[model samples]
Target: MGMTTDPFSLLGLEPTAALDPAVVRQVFQERAAAVHPDHGADAADRAERTALFASLNEAQRCLSSTPQRLRVLLQVRYPELAASHAGAVMDGAFMELFGAVGAALEKAKAVQSRRAGVVSALARAMLMADETMAADAVMGALGAVNDAMGALERALPALDETMRSGEACGPQLKAAAARAGFLEKWQAQLRAAHAGAVG
Candidate 1:
């Protein structure tokens, strides 16, 4: 769970800097086979197997991709990575890249919330609010998420400075962490909506 430890190591694999998704999958499958509940007939091995299976799943899922892996690693080991990257003051090139990404995320949130709010409001209107008003509320929540993400982004430079300069307690980092929490929830809702649409 901590970034200091390689997730691959948890699965009994060397924590290599280079990625091999196939190898990771192979290790996970092997580990899970040894510990899965299907092997629980043997009481002595059941608990251990279950624990190993769970850990295998976590390691596989978390390390399967760069963003998820990075996010997981940062949230665990380098949470300071979030704040410093979000609010730090930097040269034009870095700032431009950060700003562009922030803008894209905001745009995505706006579009998703607009579409989701329409459906959510239609479903919730009987709760006393009109359809239009309900939709607006949903969109408003999306905007709030976007704003929080933006603030989180803004704090990256400051977070980096604080972490790099060895400033232990960073207000910018705290704010960015809070914003990341909000963003996670918002992103989840969006994902659920997307899944529902797909289904």
Candidate 2:
């Protein structure tokens, strides 16, 4: 509606980290339909519509996740603070867990890759036990990652509360963002490992 970079404004949403997914979806659908190129008047209008559509998609993506939404808000509301916050580090324990999960994923991948090259049934059978073990290890890693994510999610409300109250400085948000990134990456690796084991 307005030529602004504020994602919430672009998405026709109230500027808050706590967003309802349903509302975001509904608004995006309505706006996207309204700006569909088929409904544009001319080439110029179509170009503008295309840009708006892209912006709307980006806005929806940014608002759909807690950490991403927080990051966007920080960039918009406190650019200087956010710049400094970039150097913030995640907890040492979280980093340790992430490292362990990554190592497990690599081990699983190595087993899966080795199994892929085995042509003979006997050779494949010989590797089945190792494959099974690797899969089990991946599951164990996934469980640990999930546990860590659960703890982080549980603490998110407190962080949100502090941010809302202006009590949380930049580092707090930065740390949460960093942890979220690590958790997201770990979960993705776990998914890939699980899929490899399954298929």
The candidate maximizing lDDT is: 2
lDDT over C-alpha atoms for residue 164 of model 1: 56
TM-score of model 2 (CA atoms) = 0.84
Q: How much is 123 displaced in model 2, in angstroms?
A: 1.4
Q: How do the residues 1-199 of candidate 2 rate in per-residue lDDT, one tens digit apiece?
A: 1436878877777666556778988998898999987778999999988988988888877777766776776676567877773465666887788777977888788888897799999998888887788888888888888888778767766766777787745667666666766777788889899778756
How much is the lDDT of residue 131 in candidate 1?
30
Deviation in angstroms for 21 in model 2? Answer: 2.9
- Report the error of model 2 at residue 191, Å: 1.1
Instruction: Itemize residue pairs with steric clashes in candidate 2.
Output: none
Alpha carbon deviation, residue 120, candidate 2 (Å): 1.4
RMSD of 2: 2.9
Off by over 4 Å in 1: 2-6, 67-91, 106-199
Note the Cα lDDT for every prediction shown: 0.54, 0.76
Which 10-residue span in candidate 2 carries the lowest summed lDDT?
82-91
